[model samples]
Target: MSGSTFALRVAQGVGFTGAAWLSGNIAALSANSVPAIISSVREDNISPNVACKQWRNMYEAGKTQNPPIAFATASSFAYVAWSVRQIPRSLAASAAYGGFGMYVAAAVLTLSIVPYTVAAMRPTNNALLELAESKGDRVTSSAEVEGLLGRWTTLNWARSLLPLAGGFAGIAAALL
Candidate 1:
């Protein structure tokens, strides 16, 4: 019922929604034929087979991206909540140990936010590379420069803020 618990629930809900959306997209792509994929890719102005390949590649890249870090931070926040819940019913000896445990848990939880933020901020080079290749452009400043710059700039902006927001959340969790 506390604010941190509410925030953690929100984070979990968002994560689940994202995971579901990604899974659904993957399934839809998988069920489509090669030609369908190719046509879709071409319609999007990307290379042949890039749709299927990029889908799988991006998914793999995300495995090492922001989601895992967010999940870890959320999990740690949940643990902190549980630890706080334990404090009131504890005996003197139990209170001391439990309080120490809670502090440790909070610190660990806070520490986890850093990695999550870092992961979120870090650009997915694989995605960028695939996009670059699909465009058949050597330098990003070519005729297809807009596409290249757009993608990179969008990702860069996301990376810049993710860590800061994550760190703020971690500090908030610790304070809670």
Candidate 2:
């Protein structure tokens, strides 16, 4: 048993499982809501400014939140635990060991979203925030915000897909 402390294994399990659930939820939530934004504007002819404003507010609020805190914390702990000692392993424990590796991969991949967001999306995000703050509800029609929103929508998919992968990895870990 490679001195696989019960506590370390448990923490790894939590980290990977939490990553799966949290990342999956974040990805699903983003995907589900994006269509609604587009639909509401096209179907109802709602103002783009209003939509942008809503999105800006949501982004601002979400920025302060940590949806992946559980995954992060657990993963961090698991990493630390592993640094001290690799989780004990054997062919019999392949399911768990493999799953743990996947979870770690998930964490690594999920973190990759930061660079894309910072490089590609942050500019547009900042502009949208400023526009919403300065213009508020007065801007009429959706055309004004289309390009930024479009870019945002597209880049967001990149951010979301990794977590989805992590989530599936977590599921594998949990089952195996």
Top candidate by TM-score: 2
In terms of lDDT, model 2 sits at 0.61
Per-residue lDDT of model 1, residues 1-176, tens digit only? 98866765565344334333433332332244323544455466664335435544554564465456545544544554564545555456555454445534433433343464346533544544455456444333222333433443444444434334433443444444
Give me the runs in candidate 1 sitting further than 4 Å from their true place: 1-65, 89-141
* Total backbone collisions for each predicted model: 1, 3
The C-alpha lDDT values of all candidates are: 0.44, 0.61
C-alpha lDDT of candidate 1 relative to the true structure: 0.44
Give the Cα error of residue 172 in candidate 2, in Å.
6.8
Q: Write one digit per residue (lDDT tens) for candidate 2, span 87-173.
A: 466664766566667656655664555565677778888877876776554554466576666777777766666655655654555
- Note each model's CA RMSD in angstroms: 11.3, 4.4
Tell me the lDDT of model 2 at 94. Answer: 69
Cα RMSD, model 1: 11.3
